[model samples]
Target: MKDSNFLKENNARHMWHPMAHPADSLANPPKIVVGGDGVSIRDIDGKEVLDAVGGLWNVNLGFSCEPIKQAIAAQLDALPYYSTFRGTSNDQVIELSWMLREFFEPDGLTRAFFTSGGSDSVETALRLARQYHKVRGESGRTKYLSLKKGYHGTHFGGASVNGNANFRTQYEPLLPGCFHIPAPYTYRNPFNETDPEKLAQLCATALEDEIAFQGAGTIAAFIMEPVLGAGGVIPPHASFMPMVREICDRNGILLIADEVITAFGRTGDWSGSRHWGVKPDMMSTAKAITNGYFPFGAVMLNDKIADVFEQDTSGRGAIGHGYTYSGHPVGAAAAIACLKETQRLDVAANAGARGAELFAGLNGLAEKHDLIGDVRGGHGLMCALELVSDRAAKTPIDKATIGKIYEATYEAGVMVRVSGPNIIMSPPLILTVEDVQKIVDALDAGFSAA
Candidate 1:
């Protein structure tokens, strides 16, 4: 039996991949990654490919960091798992919480609740937002508002709160009271302009209109990513977040910053809020927390909301929520290691520099490729290339053409991500200038072929 066929057969028999059709995967089997080191992954066929997406926008410290591996191993040897439920705790979990607080350092960030990953983290934030209002005697505030094209997570609450229609259409009847408004997408602004500040104010005005339409009293919180991640790598318009912050404050609504893909070093800052100069009442984070070495996520809350829980909860009710692995010791240990590495290596600084290089490189690609409609990115090792059949009208490539570009790029040995008709490049924070150039070259070649 052929070696490739043997592995493919095994996968066909039992494996089901996410975001992919089983039949399609079987016909063109998934690339079986066997190992990783630095910013590269090795397929089972021994082909080395640059990991441009950081394993779904995690892995900030990149493929194999000795410290993270050692930390996890040490934790496994000492205490593999421990629950943060019912008042029991572990040293790693406790320390990691404080560490995150230090990293964020925003006013009112006083508590941390851990989850296994991003979806759970989103759920945690959603629940906390609803409960905060309830505890404050504003139980009428049950509505959540997110931005257009935003992605929170895959859970029912998150899916409902999310504004991307494609992710929510098939699973309708999602949690009621979720709403959406226009995002600060300057490239394709509803009102056309290149001025970031003007675009920002316009977007904020749209949000205000939405709130007026729904009655702001019914809104619990407005959730968004400071720098859009999976949706399109779109950054917030200039001063957009500051204006949004004021809007939330004025309406007495919580601001939930979903930094699942932008936390840690991704955005050249510990949190995307800091990167964008916005202050969130609470933040949802995962992906980079453990640097993709382990699965972990967390909801960091400010003092304002934690105070509500402190008062008179003894008789009214328990908080009534927590995952079994809420604060897993192993995940905590890995996160601690990852944080230490981030500080020691200054990965955020690296990302700041690399992001500039990457953006310039992709923009350079735009000058060469007429198929490239737009290139968007900033200090986050994040980028998006919107493909277009007509540059002036900004008409997107047909789905078939996009699939061909995606497959061509993958076959050319660069693993990236695609959203809608746009290609996303989120190279890990550890990438070097040369690594970034390789990615740009591959994308250039792929676009040329497609």
Candidate 2:
């Protein structure tokens, strides 16, 4: 193997990482992951750590998913690359579309529009939402609404609707007519409401108020992650999504479920919307679609939206948006293998079981460590630990303190994610009881060091 120092130096000098300052990479060199097996990753320094983050919450089947690997190789051998754009389509994409229709049947999504990844999927859904309105002669419906602290991707349209300032401050002058409502985040909310049910009702009311203020006739769609991911795994109350769905229906607005992190058995259900017994008008899915083996995603459309596009005779239904690799055969093959294995193993049950264990462990850690201000989880495998300097004041821990805890956690043999003052974990759904314990042990050690 090459010298670890040499590799680190080169990586620091040559690469700029996403969601990080380029200069900071040199000061705190990132761990160079060399290889992965099952739920563990080996860094260039030759230390193996339990990957509690699941490769950015996408590697649902873990690193050693052989069937998916084989499928990709086989697809490459047969047909390396092919586009599913206008005037052309591939057999792999056609087969995958049928499979997706059946898979997302409960969500009422009957058609799949392929994209390159989650961001592309969000862009497609947003554009299609507007076009759907145009097809029905409601061109005035051009506005969007979302929950504050919700993350949708980084595209112009997605970023415009995104509620987090961290992702939008620098890219100002984004698309207009995008607004936000308060999320049902019980930890820190403007309502000062601690009860989950009350919080859900308040947030839903806020959504209704926003629509009234903005005029429902001018709104195109309401997009949100059923369980907010990158904004810190904030899962809403059981009543939240269903209420939002009813509100959108009454307002003549479409609902887009951004299931990038909570789809395909991640939330102990096929889709997060199903977890709450709500079917969205459109669903943006990616991340685990191909088990993170390939860059692929799909924006699913329900029958109502499909009918509008299908029955349009005004030439407005012709899609003017698509990526060159929208439906690459290789990605489709990988997705097929992933879907089969996901259903065969029934990872959702395991996710629920292991998630309970993980959540309990995190709650235990919170009791032991005063730094842990809040522990959030219970929906499925996704969880987060928000750190604070003072429990009463809820003062956020500084970056230096978070860095110390992160390094200690890495040294203790578990790799989690640091998002602001939150330690997020989205371990592979295939995790065993032993794996869950190891992650807790690592975090315990990290808290001790901090």
Candidate 3:
């Protein structure tokens, strides 16, 4: 193992991290996480803190998941890697596909098209969506619609549909014909409505309006996150997704639920689409699919979408998009084990129970801390506290203040993600009630310092 000094130097000098300024590494060095146990991670300085970010919203089973680890090791020894492209298919991936089919069967997703990660999953889904339309003789349907604050992924296709300016601004001119509608955000919205149901109706109306303006025949699909994870853990009303589903059904537009962060019990359900009782035509999943042990993902397709390709005699029906590491054996093995443990433990139930406690605790913090402008979550393990300098004006908290809070919270024994003015938390599903209290208590310490 390299010493701390060497590690720190290389971290600043050689590596560039995602979603961070390259210069920031030298100015404010990134913490070097050396080891993890259960849900707590030990940094290079041997300081341990409960990880509230959950390895970028993927590590649902946490760092020390033995089953996934063993599966990876065993698969490596047997068959380290193999492609799922064309004729060649390995045993692990085959078994994994069968498991996935059964696992996501309730969501009306019967087919699995594997990918390397979230971005790839989304990219594949988008291409397939366009192709699906073309195969169905609707070659003109190439446009996409999504929530204004929703996040898909980093790929050009995903970024085009991505609603956040932070992810889109510098990358434009993105794919043409991609549009966004107002998200069902209760705290701050263009509509100024606070009621969840009402906001949902307005948001759905916005989607309808966009479709009408774009001409429904031109839109291929409406893609969205089930709970809106990266754009700040914004969980929509119960009726929101169902409304969108109905809208899509009526327009003959595919509803592609981007479940990268909300799948595998992150939203207190096996899959986020199932949470709202709406079945999407296609769904993109990753993150917890292998419990973050492997960089793997799958784009799930329903019978409606699959039938178009399966029964197509024309060459256009044949799928053209795929990743080289689509169904890597090692990743497949990890996913297989993860699916077993994920179901056996029924982590969704724990996520729901613990989430209620965390949400209540955060609300308590909101009452005490003037910095917290809004507290969002009641959905599951997904939660966020949007901070503000002044509650009345809802002015976003400064970076320095957020940094202070982050340092203080780490000192108080918790590791939370500070995304702009939002303190986002998507902790492990296995986290207990006691763990929930520690996170809240640590955040309280953070706020108290301010």
RMSD of each: 1.9, 0.9, 0.8
- Pitting candidate 1 against candidate 3, the one with the higher TM-score is 3
- Candidate 1: tens digits of C-alpha lDDT, residues 239-338: 8888999999998989999989888878887678887677789989888888888888999998888778877554433578989888899999999998
Runs in model 3 deviating more than 4 A are none
Every model's TM-score: 0.96, 0.99, 0.99
Error of 1 at 334 (Å): 0.6
The full ranking of all candidates by TM-score, starting with the best, is 3, 2, 1
In candidate 2, list every pair of residues with a backbone clash.
Answer: none
Q: How would you encode candidate 3's per-residue C-alpha lDDT over 1-450 as one tens digit per residue?
A: 998888987887787888989898779989999999999999999999999999999999999999999999999999998777898999998999999999999999999999999999999989999999999999999999988889999999999999889998998999998988999999999999999999999999999999999999999999999999988999999999999999999999999999999999988889999999999999999999998999999999999999999999989887777888999999999999999999999999999999999999999999999999999999889999999999999899999999999999999999999987899999999999899999999999999997
Who is ahead in lDDT, 1 or 3?
Answer: 3
Across 249-344, the per-residue lDDT of candidate 2 in tens digits comes to: 999999999998999998889899999999999999999999999999999999999998899888998989999999999999999999999999
Residue 63's C-alpha lDDT in candidate 2? 97
Instruction: Pull out the clashing pairs in model 1.
Output: 108-302, 108-303
